[model samples]
Target: MNKKIRFSDINMMNDYQEERWGYRVFELAVTNILNDELLQKKFPSLNEAFFQKVDEIIAPLQLLLYPVISCFSKDPDVLSQWRAYADDGRGFALGFNGVALNSMPVTLLEVEYDQKIQIEEMKTALLAAHIRNLESGNDFGSQFRTDCQLIGAWKVGFKNSAFREEKEVRSLHMLDVCVDGDRPRLVDAGGEALGKEVNGEQVGYRVQDGAIIAYVDIPIPHLDNAPLIQEVWVGPKNINGIGNIVYFMSECGLKDYAIHQSKASYR
Candidate 1:
């Protein structure tokens, strides 16, 4: 009932197929840029300094900024989703307004499950950098930060092809690991740090599945003080009926929101 959205650390995700794939994708992109004969021929000016600078940008991206993920899906009432994600059809799927939800300070991306598309996106970003360098000449450093940010978000959105049916949309936010306990810390390009966070969103911890999970709560904003939730679908195996669920929703401060029981016959 805190009226906040929780984005948990990607490290806590149970999807082993996608774990550490972000860093792997970035590394593969770097290797392709350096050794791919076609790309090497196209961007001959990409010297050691360019890669060194990229390495500098990636270090902090890998270590300092922890990727936090909040996942949503377009489908609200799929049987597989209910069986796999909803405690075997005993939970609920929250439906949120896409426009209002994405207005928050995070990169919202559609999850790509095709391996070929994932590889191409990484390669395309590298080629885009080459083009920018050609236009800007020696000023490529100006775009490195933005490039890293794109890579950070892009790298995390690729999932295994098996998950394509989920049609997941993920909100990815990078949290600085160096931030002071309860106080925000900023690290400069030269590695200097120590500063207060302007927004004051604090990190929290919870124990899940025998492991400690770290997350940050983003305060949900109400539009004209209206409820942000659009609807919720109760799972098929949920023991509680709609009446009790409606009462729970009221206690959670939601009003006039539509609630539906899962149509799946799965028990």
Candidate 2:
């Protein structure tokens, strides 16, 4: 059967259950061991052919979309925190060790910030770096050089600026477990009800692409900080080695989304 594992954020969720989930679409796909036959029957393409029931590509059952943030290594401290997280998967104790950093290889590159930006506004400039990376491609920033997934992005920056750096990730919130017993009910990334709650009837949104769009503004303590109005697609870096079962958003796919959104809003 052509089963579409639709996200609760954009579907009827006809036979779903009542509960919260903490994982991304890619993660869930690996967890469920998505059925390859069904997936190919669903989303067939040249790109779709490359994905097999393997380490990175499983059976293609994941059905949620997340943002991919671009990371800019501009400061020593920022790089250090990222290294710590990447090396030990202990991101300031933020439940962010989704990938086993020690087992996999890492490549770090550093690019300079414009001296014209001024040191005082360095924080703001950094935020801009992330936004620019996501909205546009970062020709001036460091490269991740690997396919990774973004898991948790809820963090504080500035002195801990590395937390704000854009990274790849592999999961999101939906039913980590089958809630309805027969079929799993997917919810928003935050686990909010996808549709309006009612005893006999219900009301909700079904626009898949109309999922929630958030813009976070974190203020930093500094002098040269520019007025940052960031609309970046922030996601976690999906490193290698934590589990052979992990999957994540492709960098190219995310860039397409970011570029489309930027043109609609800014261009």
Candidate 3:
């Protein structure tokens, strides 16, 4: 009766610009800092060598655990969302309970698309990483690595302004691969197959557009006396009727949820 939710790789997302914009912002911030004479004079510790070191640490994290994300749109019935994501009005849009979503052990945050804000955030993370590196006396760069992981995960949440209209709130989690002898295993945030297993499979991978995409199925707990799912919006081109939807929901043991028809006139 418990359903598992899948979070896909940010890089393998439908949007080609996913996470690329954030990296560009990071690059731009570092470039500006390195070029500015007054800034370099003020913070002599943050030189090219320091930036390169930070990049070296961060690059592996980015490659190894490129933050898998589950995105939820604030507007459930937008025309563009339906067309771009939902098989051009043929699929259904599920509305989840925000309160229930927040209750789960996940990193749920709103996506930032503003270039100016992203640049500032990138700069701040870089400065913090540098400070952490300087303070780590015995453990070496361990604290910096931990800080970079958080910052790297944060970078995945930064999308381009073009996707700003989606008004997305994303659940971010990292997927790390550890090679043990012959086989490679996927590790999640908490290391328990990224939380839990689904149907004896902790993680699942499928080929999409000739590329293998990895996803983890996290169990969605049924809230006590509350519905985890709020509603289901039938897409514009969907031919299913009210009776069919009601029957499906009933058979699935889903209760206290409404079904609405999308108002979009797309054929």
Candidate 4:
């Protein structure tokens, strides 16, 4: 007979899944917000406000993203635990985790304010709403309170993610950018510098929109073994010639490059 795999056993195998699970929780909250009829009726502009709040909240919440991802990725056993709770059709298992449900009332307050559009008026409205819900003593009202608390916790996770921590020194490369029919330039920490006459310079080249451009090679010592190259583009198109640069970084073992910024294009 085959033995059932315990949640603990799965968790030990892959721990990063916990973070992913947290994201799932966040998604559930979003769904609830979208589906809440009373919430929608109370705040006719709920959709816009909800999304706007989500954007404002995401940066702070990002701190939790990686940890939750890591938790689930590092442990497969945790999934079993989550699945056991979600065995019912709902895909969410509500347990009394004792997470405070009313600590951060900003989102709720915002919802109330949005309805009244007046500070003092909204405060009175929210107080009345809270009292009315409490007085009902119904399961629906209780669940509504629970959902609000869960959303608050999710926000806390996001705020926590925004806090900075010490990061390990990693190798990074610099790519000099040059434009056609103009002087060559290199970019570094200080800024862009025009190229002077130099012998035995190994220039790197990349094709952009079918035009081959030249780059001066500065072998970054720390990043010598680093496979990624961070390219800073200088243009004959501009006075400084350093218009846009691309930074190539690694995330989750995948090589990716981003166009950091760009200048206004002529023509």
TM-score winner: 3
| Per-model CA lDDT versus the true structure | 0.73, 0.25, 0.77, 0.29
Q: What are the models' TM-scores? A: 0.82, 0.17, 0.85, 0.22
Write candidate 2's Cα lDDT for 7-45 as tens digits.
Answer: 222122211210112122223333232344553354333
Tens-digit lDDT string for candidate 1 (1-267): 887778887878878755567667666767766777776776777656776666577656646676777888989998888988889999999888776676566778888888777777887886677677667765756676677656765678888787888999998766665746776543321111122223536767899889988888776555665567889888999888778978888888787778888888886
The predicted structure with the larger TM-score, 1 or 4, is: 1
Runs in model 4 lying further than 4 Å from the true structure: 1-13, 63-267
Instruction: Looking at model 3, report the run of 10 residues with the lowest lDDT sum.
Output: 192-201
| 1-267: candidate 3 lDDT, tens digit per residue | 466578887779878987667678878889877887887787788888887766776667765765777899988899999998899999899998876776554678888889888888888888878777777752436687777677766777788888888999998766667676988777665432334432323667889989999887676656788787789999999989888888888887887888888999999
Candidate 1 regions with alpha-carbon error over 4 angstroms? 17-19, 29-38, 46-52, 179-198, 225-227
Per-candidate clashes, comma-separated: 0, 21, 0, 29
lDDT string for model 4 (161-247, tens) is: 211121111111222334446754433222121222223234435655565544333321122233332222222132331121212
Among all windows of 10 consecutive residues in model 4, the one with the lowest summed lDDT is: 1-10
Model 1 scores a TM of 0.82
lDDT of 3: 0.77
Error in Å for residue 12 of model 2: 13
Ranking by TM-score: 3, 1, 4, 2
Worst 10 residues of 1 by lDDT: 188-197
